[model samples]
Target: MIDCGRAKRPGWSPSVHYAGTAIDLLVIQNLDEDHVEDLSELLRTVTVRSVFSNPTVTASALASMKPDGMRTGVSTAHNVLRDFGPGLIGRWPDTGEVQVVHFYCRFGTHFTETNDLSLATFFRWGNFTILFGGDLETAGWQMMLRNQEFQRLLVGTQVFVTSHHGRENGKCAELFQIMRPDIAVISDDAIQYGTQEKSTQWYRDKVKGIPVLGTENAYGIRDKRHVLTTRRDGTISIAVGAWGNYLVTPEKVQNELTLGEILGAFGRNALSKDSQVA
Candidate 1:
């Protein structure tokens, strides 16, 4: 799992229950309350093999830096990291053809902010490539860009999960010049803050638009979207095939029960009842 933040509408508990399997790895990107609020609950429910996070962020350090309310979540995260130990920095196991490379940023060195210290993940399965920039901000991105290996990994990223939930602060033009993805996904709630709303167009401009499933406009035309957001797209599921061909399917779609279809079903039921009576 990428991040285990709690949400009222699209909670992770239901999906985890339905899967009926233990989580092999849990990657905590940001140390903020929104990201780690349900950390303790998640640990209690599932048997996670390994956890990957910033090693420098200890419970005591967090308690001192963060507010009082964030103590519980921080404690849980700290305990888990201490117990499991941070997962290896290089290639992860059991992935088959999928190449998974985790890039770690040194905390309390160049940057001390939790967002800047976020872990960046790169995945390449066949031709499909995905880059998850955790919650890294502009400075963090710029710092990572200096690494030649990191730059090489960003070459053919088809799907890029926007950092800091597509906020303006996460926008890095220099990084965009290196990695141009087909679709930019922003995993965030509805527009509660200005940061979420302001950078919509900027992210769109960064990526080449991809064909979005079930997003036909009013004119019966399927719209190609450059950006996909949890606020609008709900749970976004990307299924990549053996040959690297992939499909991006959002949970919420434009497919609704039409009046004509409803009436037809009703009429069919009525006819069946009449025949039975006869």
Candidate 2:
């Protein structure tokens, strides 16, 4: 599991329960509340084998870095890391043959900002590769790009999860020069900040567009999208085959169903309930 956060919904614990699988590893990429809010609840509900995060990021360090001082989630994240310790690096058996790589800036030496200290994850399964840049800013990405190994890893990234929820601050034009992904995904809510709204086009321009299923515009025209967001698409799922071919499916698509289809489903449900009663 990566970054435990919740909004109006009940968070990810319910899904974990329903799936009936214990978390082999929980990767906390950013120390912010939105990234670590449900840490305590998750620990209580299920058994997590290990946790992967920046080792230098202590609760006190995080609190001092933030303008608002300590938050409950940050403290909880620190405690979990202390108790569980850092997860091992290498292939995880639970996740099949997928390989994982973690990247982060050193606390005082490389970055003063907490966002730069965010752990960046790289995953590879067969020819499929994806990158999750957890709130990492331009400077942080620039530093990582200097590393030859990190550069090699970015070469074949098919999907790129935008940092800082696709905020303008996280945009690193230099990084995209080397890493040309097929699609970019932003894990964000409604547009609350100007940075969130402004960077959409920039990200879209960076990636090559992918064919999206069940998505159509208001004019009833279906267009291929280069970017996808949680705010627009409820939940996005990616299934990769053995040969690295993949399919991207979104939980909700725009104009996917008409009013008549919705009403017909409701009518059918009512009839089914009536039949049960009879």
TM-scores for all candidates: the values are: 0.81, 0.81
Top lDDT prediction, candidate number: 2
lDDT of the candidates, in the order given = 0.71, 0.75
Clashes of 1: 0
Per-residue lDDT of model 1, residues 32-137, tens digit only: 7677777777767676666767666655545545554455566777666555554443334476787878776676666666788788888898777899988898
lDDT of 2 by residue, 1-278 (tens): 88777754434443355244577777889888888776776767776676777877655566567766656677787665455444442335477689988998988888867799998899999888999999999999999999999999998898899999999889999988898988899998878898787798999889887644434478745567788898888777775655666666565642465546534433433423111000
Weakest lDDT window of 10 consecutive positions for candidate 1: 269-278
Estimate the overall C-alpha local distance difference test score of candidate 1: 0.71
lDDT at residue 253 of model 2 (Cα atoms): 41
